[model samples]
Target: MDATWILRLDAVGDGPRIAVKDCMDVAGTPSTVGCRVIAADALPATLDAPVVETARRQGARIVGKANLVELCRHADGINPWTGTPVNPLDSARVPGGSSSGSAVAVAEDEADIGYGTDTGGSVRVPAACCGLVGLKTTAGRISTQGVFEFSRTLDTVGPLARDVAGAALGMAMLEPGFTIAEPPTGTPPPLARLRLPDVDPALDAAIDDALRTAGLQTTDVRLPQWRSWITAAKDLASAEGYWAHRHLLDRSEHLEDRHAGGIRQGRDFTAAQVLACRRSGRAASAHLNALLDRFSALALPTLAFEPPRIGEVRRGSMTYLTAPFNLAGLPALALPVPRGAGALPASLQLVGAAYTEESLLALGAHVEAALAANRR
Candidate 1:
């Protein structure tokens, strides 16, 4: 298995362990950001990113700086310099990026929680791939300061862990005064079961069966703007990403060609196009809010396809099921639902209204319990 950490060290504090994504400054360590060029040029961070500081203030022992895709760009974890974190479920398969190492660290029990940033599925994709729980807090709900971000507008520090409870702990570390809502005991929360094209049948069956077993009410929702939302997110990300790291071009000699190409994508969009995409993002958020007003949350597969083997993913493929929520700036929870004994698990993504992480996580906990009982 490839190394899951950029820098491993003695535990930093006296509480539950945390594996912070290398893109976030951890103080005293150079934030390698899973890039050789950046690593060579980077200096030790003099202070912790606010997100990382929360964990320290809460008594979390910072155990290691986890690796991620270079520039936090790719959907699959395949960093040539840092090496991809082998998927704990199957070493030959891909661990999703750019939070791959953070996911693997938690999956392998190296840390109680893994802190990662999710712009377009970075946190949830890795959690889905590694069979863990990942929570993408509402954009701006968590601090982005001191973190190297892909899209300044979309990036939010999130947490990945093995279960809902661990995810909550991770959230508490990222968000001061964060509370994990108690599992529902009376009526199950209403779910708007979101269906997009190209979802695997096995995944559909798993989500459907789990919700049914959990006695959760679900109403079908098929948003027509799904494709448009994806486009707007890509354009916005491209525009913002270029601005975030174009300065590294002077050191482009050390940058991977693919990453260099990604940085240049912003140049492809005209100012008019960037402005249009920004407007589209606002529309997407408003549309989603209208739906959220009725349903407790939206449920769907975290990934439309199962975790691909190493080298099997294409750019933009992994984000189809995840990016829209990020575009809408909603909090999303990716919870693993066990399939047949030998089959790989499927991830059930629950997206909630802005700042409704507590409700969403509570619903996840309830569904998790029901699925476990059904498996027994």
Candidate 2:
């Protein structure tokens, strides 16, 4: 029997098709984590990662393994081991990473949904760039047992789909003891809009137009200082990621400069620095929690700027806007909005309180349905 058929046969449900990110173990396949070094000698997984197993058990067809950034290190989705996947919307531009292929698969209609681990903005970035919906559920909401780690505390299994309903359906299968809530009939709670000091005017206008089209009310608010929190998140992510793959880095015959660079940054951080970063995370979480208490969700642009060109190092505040939620361990949903003049999709992000993924999905579904009706 063909190996692809064998894998697809394991799927139990007559449900949506899904492509698991390469970093995730799929039982009969080697978990490459998007690096030739790992794939060259790695053994096939003896068991599926919990997320993948659950997805198959829930009837989602395991179409194939999607490519990712090398070692899941870069946000740009360039993987030398497996060629970069082009954004379906704009072939000249990069499909966001480290979940690049997963997003591309969905965007190109190869799969109904794509499952990937989100550490930082992996899933959201690609989803937005591909004009899809992606959710980074609260930390610990989905099991990560067989998935390769980036940051144990920040890593999460999330899904990207063409619409909010597809994402919600995918989440139900991947997350144990979780299901999408029924559509809310009453008015949605007020949304607290987050206006970054340097937000792009075009993106801001798109967000406002989306809210107005959906008849959603928004009140402006600000959370704790984002730069400090993001800095800490980066430091800790580097440290954790370094330790998780230290053996590979030490043993591999040849390590790519990009992968080696990230690993090396984490090598020098003392335990004391990790602790300080944790403390910073706690403070940021507390402030965000307080704001959530007063608002249904915090709204912001998923990406403050356009997707960077292939091979360009994206530098600036726009790159770190989603880092705060990952550091805070909150639930964030990235929903595709209207396209910009360049034809690439604009995305609006909704950050919810911890463990509030169901509510967030409910709200997202509502907005998705409203927007699809051409309410304007």
| TM-score, every prediction | 0.97, 0.93
- Per-residue lDDT over 1-376 for candidate 2, one digit per residue giving the tens place of the 0 to 100 score: 1111112324545678888888888888887777877877889999999888887777778888888887888777776556778777777777888898888888888788899878889888888778899999898888989998889988988999999888888887887567777766777778999988667788888888888777889998865587788899899899998898888777555677768878878999999999999888888889999989988899889987877777564643334778888889998999998654556668989999999989898888877877778734
TM-score of 2: 0.93
Q: Pull out the clashing pairs in model 1.
A: none
lDDT for model 2: 0.81
Model 2 misplaced regions, further than 4 Å: 1-13, 183-186, 251-253, 315-318, 340-342
Over the full model, what C-alpha lDDT does candidate 1 score relative to the true structure? 0.89
Model 1 alpha-carbon miss at residue 197, Å: 0.7
Q: Report every candidate's CA lDDT.
A: 0.89, 0.81
By TM-score, the best candidate is 1
